[model samples]
Target chain A: MINVLVGSTVLPGNLEAVLEIYRELVARTRNEPGCVSYELLQLREDPCDLMLLECWLSQEHLDAHTRTPHFVEAIAQLEMLETAAPALIYTKSV
Target chain B: MINVLVGSTVLPGNLEAVLEIYRELVARTRNEPGCVSYELLQLREDPCDLMLLECWLSQEHLDAHTRTPHFVEAIAQLEMLETAAPALIYTKSV
Candidate 1:
């Protein structure tokens, strides 16, 4: 499987906003072709952080998704996030 | 957070082979910059499946890693895997 993970720290009072973003991301990915699973997870012990798993059939499909206009727009909107550390990764297992 | 997940089906008699691949992948990635957490996870209920979480700093960092020779070399070795389904993803949560 190919996996994509995006993580962010939630602002003190922005839990609702964080949830909204997560819900939207999940809904958007679930119907995509080759999407085996899309999971939005919060660290059980770390209320301030969240992680998402995007599982797809191949690197090519994933790359295509990342380049879509929707994804580009999402990034633009999230640029104002108040978190300290944010990350995105693309990886394949050995 | 940046998350990279990789998943695969384990071959019927290749348990040791699978473990060796995981060990090496973990060792090679653990020290990389912006790598906050690298986990090799075998599904609790699915003996034939495995998942890995490669949490890193940013999209740029992840993209660079994907372009590295090691990742390419790893791919060549795994091309012979006997799994029915293999997948990859690149995603950013909204």
Candidate 2:
């Protein structure tokens, strides 16, 4: 499986709302084919900093996930909430 | 539990040595009092890029881990192998 971490910094006042959106998105994402695990984590030092740890069967599976309606919708909302673009890192199991 | 992702870029030609060091460190760290999980993951696109996903019972537990002899030794070696200082992000479980 492929491991991916997507990091984003949410605007100060938008964390709760953005978190709700992520909750919905993660719920939907877990049901997609090839999804092994998906979780949203909030930084303790800066609660507005968020990270999503995702495990998928393959790069293709991940690409497909990005194309889904849930992803598209979530990304649109997340873009508005984000202070900057997300940082995505893809890794393989050791 | 506290979730921490520590990201680092290894100096080229140092990946194998660093990975071995990490393997040993993870083995030792897993036995630490508050360590829930400690794993090393390498970026698929850039093998020299590494990330360590760590789970600890509390910030105090994490701080203690940092002071351990094994940690001190491993970190010293890691510093020499790293292209830059590691980026550490601590988050709470959602």
Please, what is the whole-model Cα lDDT of each candidate in the order they appear? 0.63, 0.82
TM-score, candidate number 1 = 0.48
Chain B TM-scores of the candidates = 0.76, 0.89
How many steric overlaps are in each model, in order?
11, 0
Q: Supply candidate 1's per-residue lDDT for A21.
A: 62
**How high is the TM-score of chain B in model 2?**
0.89
What does DockQ come to for candidate 1? 0.06
Q: Per-residue lDDT for A22-72 in model 1, tens only? A: 577667777777877777666545555666666678877777776766666
What are the per-residue Cα lDDT tens digits for candidate 1 across B1-94? 5555566677758766766766776777777777776766554345556666666777677777667676666566665663524333333343
- Candidate 2 at A2: error in angstroms? 1.3
Q: Per-residue alpha-carbon lDDT of model 2 for B1-94, expressed as tens digits?
A: 7888888898778888888888889999999999987888888778887888888999899999999999999989988888544555566534
Q: Point to the candidate with the largest DockQ.
A: 2
